[model samples]
Target chain A: MASIVWLAPAVTPATEAGDDPLLPPFGAELIVDFDLALSPYSEGSDDQQEVFRAFALGLHAGRRWHRWGVGLAVEGTLWRTLDGRGEDDWFGALHTGLEGSVLSAGGRIRTRVGGGLALLLEGTALDSAGGAGFYVDLRPAGLRWALDDAVVGFDPLTLFMTLPDAGGIPLVDVQYRLCIYAEFGR
Target chain B: MSARTYPLLLAALGLMTLPAAAHGYSLQTAVSDSCHERITVSSLDVLLDLVDDVSGFEVPDDPLLRQLLGRLQFPGTEDASLQVRFVMFSIIIGVRSPDTDGHSTFNLAALRRLHADPAPRGQYAHALRGPGDDGIAGDLAAVDGTIAAILDEVQTGASLSAGGVIADKPAYLDHYGVVDVPVALFAWHVGRALHALQDAHAHMIWDAEVEHIVGVLNYIDAVEGRLEDADGLAHSDALDDCHRDDVAPLVEAATRRTRALTLAIVEAARTRDGAALRAGLAPCVDDATDRDACGWIVYNPPCRAAIRAGDTDAVEAVCCDDANDFCGSPYAAIARQEAVGPYLGCATAPAGQSGGWAWGLGLLGLAWLGRRRRFAAPTALALLALARPAVAAEADEAADAADAPPRLSVVVEGHGSALDDRVDAAILSPAFGYGVRAGWQTGRWRFGLHVDRDYWVSVEYGARVDGGVLDVAAFAEGLFFDDYVRVAFALGTSTLMFDTELHSTGNTGVFSEIRPLGLRFPLGERLWLVLDPFTTTVVMPAIELDDRLPSLRKVQHRTIVGIEGGFL
Candidate 1:
């Protein structure tokens, strides 16, 4: 009885402190993106070329890139071109080299034009397919036009259309994309 | 043709005489009105079949007879309609259709020049004339046993496997031959048969089979969840085919043998204790792959006890099959992970693709026939429906959607092809369009729309010839049924159109679709699987030139029965 009474104080409400607000919805969410497309690809050649009709899906779990995060993307090609005789095959590649996007005028200045590394592996099952590639990407912040989500129309929402459009701003030729991330973290 | 052959000729005529509309057969009137040319051509087919039948009976050797009979034999489950056509095609073409086109000609001169003095063609006559044994009871028993064994295997392994293979354990480490085949082959067949059974009305009678599989899912899922909760284990290596195929999973859990991710169950089994084995599952739940595994397992002693007591039902209900695990919502994230990174292109190839073994042989035989003769005349001339009929077929034109305007869509689908281990450049092609789509969103209703289109402007299909070749095109039409996806059957037609040149044959090869009934699964908002069992009936315009060689500009009917899916 005595020990129970002695321990009661620690468990009592009087010792309680105020709340801690450390848990969620406030941190900057780091973001990474990858391209996941399989195809009888069109609008591209038999070589290692990136076809635009294809789009990207979230892949390889989201990785935060606000810190020192860099990405290398590689895409391979498989092709079997058919003429009267039979099949002639080739490959292609599209990649980039740079750091995140920048804040520039000229529509985010579409900074960091790309040059990707490539190789051609051949044989058959009669077609070209997987290839190896590596590249770096960078985009900067800039102001531009965008549609406001709330308005659901061309409300001319303000956008940070930087070279590497990461915040709901539109950019071109993304190594898939790394735009606005929807997360609980900041 | 002689009077003796007239009976068969009449029977053939009768079979073809079904009201074309009942089978949804149409006269394809849009092609030039080449009716007379068609009659002459069909009569020729009948005459050829009769001659071939007679020629077969002329053979005296038993061995040759048996071999031929085997070729013509129709095992149950195979489409008999196609079997009958094979006989007809073999008779008319002498070789196979494809062969006739490329290598062999079916003319008398060619037949006379052939090496064999007497082809054992009569073998089919003997087989077809033979009586069938209706041992329904015996067949039922066998089927029952096969189905039971299959279910038992699946039931035993469903707990042990993830997508037919044991989740991440190197296979070759254990007894290779014994373990692998059972898990892989047995489970695969069970799953396959389950699908087949569902397709063939088993859901109405044997719902238990489905229930059993779904029922057993609890324990396995429980274990999986626990394992996941634990800091993920290190045993995530893809097992070889052998290990993945059989009861190694049962053996692993039952024995607790671990050169890989063996459970701690067998340790208990050694003590003559199922309790230990039951407890062994705790590792999966409580002490799974990583830290999370420990959390789920460390606290669930009662659940472990329930499993140990051999009370699968209790363990299932208590641990899994609850709102958290059973409805498949909790693991959507994990499932997505598995779905995403499927090692690019090195996965095992799908069966019956491009021209697998049986198809290869079938095609080879067909190509042989194509090289041989003028089998095309009948298909080329079957155009009589465009004109006056001696017997008016009633079913035709009655079900016409002419008054019903269908909402049409033209889809340009692009998909990647695999060549061995590599993926190829995406190929984009526009599929022909035609369908009547109707959508009702809650209270909002949209007008019904009917749509249709040929693959290309021309109605001709897959025409091949000397110097001039027409491309093959795809077309589709939709038919809708009410409510419930399964209850609602979507009716549709696919047409492949192309053109070819034949001087003597009369350029009447129009609307010859080389495709058959197919099913597909949608992958994305617009993507879907397209699986079709292909069968084609060739139609053409017939211009009477001469009932001879050049007039036989050979028609080759091509059919591909296959399953192609993934991202439409």
Candidate 2:
């Protein structure tokens, strides 16, 4: 008698289950960042300090649980003097951090805050030129818009502080990123 | 509010707010101009002094001076325009003059060699002892060879002026329709010869103590990823900046060598005696060997007498100890190395003719791609057939249209850089380009192949060289708003070619283009006009002068307009 009675399984829609159609739980991003560094301890005349500019291209991967997310980012940055002097410096870094959506609008727009710590390795001819350092990348605010499987993000002002070896004073830089993420596994 | 327009707007706004600055050296006219000024001033002094010493008058009107000047076709000192023209002609033929980045003129082609030789012979007249080197003898021989080449060119020009049958003129002369081709040609060769001799003084270290040129700095090494191996005392800009306090001595030395070489060249031209040219270049040679040898024997006349008496022990005792002591200093060691074998000034052999051949093959491939239009129809039909199935279901829904949505289209585009004010005006301008794209469209997606050519002109040192960029890419586009708006992204490789006399050489790099806001307007049933407001192409490992000049990388942005015609 118990085996004869068959029951149907319950079905639930993704929206009803509090899942966002745009802000995917697992996704990857392609990022382009422009960095401007203020090296207070650089070699230059009294009136001027050697300004450094870097162009970075990167990949980011993360998994999200509701409003909180954890991610790992890897990027290669090409560094050069703003005045076009000397040779170019290249560096690669791996960043791991946590990000959370502070505000969301209709599951289409989200404002995020994130901070990451990175270990940077120099990739240049001169050994120890820009010594291997640890970087603290803090995004106090960022805005992202979702479009189906893609998300466009802009971090207007990101702060980077590098703590070099030998306990030297930290090197500070300001950066902005234009990111496009092709989301999957929503 | 379409997905296509949203990302496009965001990309455009982001690009607009990005900061940019000029990223390379200016045309480097300062270095070339300074070279010309030094040569002119020094030649005048040497000629005036020679004439005065011979005729007891402070004038350059002596018969010898006049004959030499007339034969060399030396321009009047006060005629600035003529002098500039003379220098320009010289630079055109003497150095590989068409580098857009200005390294050729700045380094005076010192990084390049006459041939792919492993020896320490640079385009600079300065030669160091190396494999296949004969020391000062080799240096003198190189100088003689350059002089011979110059005289040969002058003779050819003279013959041409005299209505002699010459089959071909120099390629560089095509742009300059000079009235006196003979004088222009002579000045050209002289300018070429003078550049090397002058560079010897600038590039080589002067030993004031021994009054001899000791060592030559290798600029090619300094800038070419071997900075650690390079001499710290000298760099690419060390002697180039004539006003630098440390460079004053080098300039003075260059002036002295310039005077010696000019006098010798003039004397040789007057007498047609090649020996006189060699003797003149001897003064410019590294005399460290003789100077070092004399240091031991001169003070100890007994050592000289012992050598005359064939007393080997006495000679070795006084001279060998002194030689060892002298070699203790790094400069003396370099000087000693110069006496025995090759010193460090020579750059390694260049990439050689293989690069030129590869460039030629690429050009031919591009030409084949351009000429084989007959294959376009079949290729388009094949692509359309492959794409038809994917859009077949959508096509069944729209039976009213004459043609299916999955049709092949060919687009021709004209574009120009939008970075005129954003980059260094001297280094780059808003150059124009043209391209073609062929693709198959299905539903809201299109995929295609694109070929583009952008022509750029580099003007420097009063000479112009044409350069170009050839881009070939594969792109994927998304159509939105009933196919009125489009956003396309492409990844491609670009080749930047410089049209120089030796060979067309260039750098090749990978690039990606994002056409953010492209509007397609219907002109007819099967034709449309495409306008892109912002297209950004970022080339990585950027295009620059050859590996010799590695620091210059440029990123270009452009706006594109095109016309597309559907087929099949």
Candidate 3:
């Protein structure tokens, strides 16, 4: 027999209160993530290195069947530093994509690994002029903890972020994110 | 795009796709469940279980899927796989439902044609338009007609006979179609119809502000009578007249009507009575209350009025004022003030700069104080270790208590990083910072206090104020993947010296920081090099400073690396 404990079946307001108690199979998540990327190789960097920081706020809704879940997410990323070449020009990206996750949990912690394809609705830092393109992302590491009434987690290693905003710019960016989510209904 | 367009887009999207709507409406799953339960209790689950086991048409336990498939006639043949029937079921239900763009899968015209000719091909005509100025006449009609048609065909057997809700024979067992069983078919049509009704309710109550998270809180508060003001509709030039707190009654009315219609349909299907079926559906058509309540006309009028006015300025003003109200709201007045303060710049205070902090230290302090009193495990562990030699002398005594619990371990960590103090211009040039973390852990979970102090390694105090920043945070850390990785978030206060011409303010600000990526490389027993490569901090002041001063309130982000170890 598999013994299951319905942790926070009603409310766990560690961070913020008024979250729905029932862990509905289908949910909408509002995530505010801080993305820090270090590109060892870049287009026009003299030092052969670029450090970028961005604040990504995304809205995603999906249905979960057991451990596997699939959904669509639209992320609006505001880049604080792009290219890191003293350009001082900030950029923004709107990434709309299909995201899939496989999650497993033990005790109060749940670990998830997710990846998907994203359409860059906006542009990259190098373009200076914003544009859109396609990219593939892989998050090998993601973890969620039951924090009070809300669930908080982050995808640490988001690799192969090739939004390809501008032509002839071969760049690879790795992203890290911190997210807080609340489940609405069952 | 104009700011006005954003709110309108949100409003439209919120009304269309209630499932994905950000506002905290709990009706989506409620309606979905009520529809599913109606069939599950009517022997639909038993039939599904048998079909799943025999014909391999099994699907996962999903609420929305269950509702959609509840009315499906399971094909008892190898040709119709689970995927095939599932897709067919989705096509039948999805065509009438709202999509992400707030449009139905099929338009009223196409749905009417599909209802006239029951087939799967016509279910794919993408509806580009939603309800018009007066609402679509044929949209709900076609849905009802199709539902009735399917239920009528499902009840059609070799001969119309009465007994135990069609348990005598299974009409769908031989045919590869959707309309065969009374239980399954009734569940499906009723579920779909109920979803439509609930969707209609979503549009009526979801005011302008229900577009985002803060707006959702306001809507919930308003509905619960916590807020005395009229709903967000009052602020909207479009929906001001529709503002009311009668959402409960409206929803209750709709729910009762839909449930009654479902039960009546089930009874008619059981007896194979065609007239009773039509009579059951009469409420959906003739009953003025249900019809009026379950139509988008409630929103279309005001929405069209706003659309015709084309008053972008008015829309923006309302949206901005709503944003202001959300910021000034009692619930959001605490942790969210710093975040919303900048957006409220158009209303209050200048748009230049705004800075404030949250006193997360008090919360952290309380937790630490509580932890100190609750956990005597550390002291007990020390005593146990000291008494090990004496206990070893008495073998019998030691053997009696052999099943002892694991000892709690104390962890301490410290690291250094480089900082770019952009806010204090040239005040802390070439800054370097160090952080320390101390906690007690038993197994995978750890609770601790983290302190980080940033000072100018090389300072040139040339008219620029230079002072060290001290940050104190409390966090919960969890080790996973066989203890190879750890993740943690810290909530605390950042005390920084704000040197202005008038006063020297060493203010404490609130912050929530997370180290999402931490990998442990063990160098020796009980010692590990815990490399946290990526750490981000969200900083704000605990107390509000004078907004008349320069806008010092800006969201701060930093990246730091640290090393940690554990010693019991």
Q: After superposition, how far is residue B34 of candidate 3 from its true place, in Å?
A: 69
lDDT of 2 by residue, B1-568 (tens): 0001113223533312111110011122311333444454446545433332221112222232222233333334444333333333333343322121122221111112121123343323322222232322232333344345444543443332222221211221111110112223433444445555454444344444324443344432332223231122222333344555655555565565555555654455445555645554343234553321112101123433555676777655643222243224333333222121111112212333212332354357447646964332323223322211111232223222223554798999998752321111221233567999999887667899988887653423333435666788898887543454456778988776653322234657776776653655555667667866445565432443432212223345566789988887
| Residue pair clashes in candidate 2 | B129-B341, B129-B342, B130-B342
Task: Judge candidate 3 at residue B93 and give its lDDT.
Answer: 37
Q: Sorted by lDDT, highest first, which candidate order results?
A: 2, 3, 1
Ranking by TM-score: 2, 3, 1
The C-alpha stretches of model 3 lying farther than 4 A from their native spots are A1-140, A144-186, B1-432, B455-468, B497-505, B545-560
- CA deviation > 4 Å runs, candidate 1: A1-33, A39-74, A77-122, A125-186, B1-88, B91-568
Candidate 3's fnat? 0.01
Consecutive 10-residue window with the lowest summed lDDT within model 3 chain A: A1-10
Mind giving the per-residue lDDT tens digits that candidate 1 earns over B435-509? 222332221112222222323222111111222122222333222111000001122222223322223222443
Q: Return the number of clashes found in candidate 1.
A: 115
Model 3 per-residue lDDT tens digits across residues A115-153 = 333223333322323333444444544445544444555
Q: What is the C-alpha RMSD of each candidate to the true structure, in Å?
A: 33.9, 21.2, 26.5
The CAPRI class of candidate 2 is: incorrect
Highest TM-score: which candidate? 2
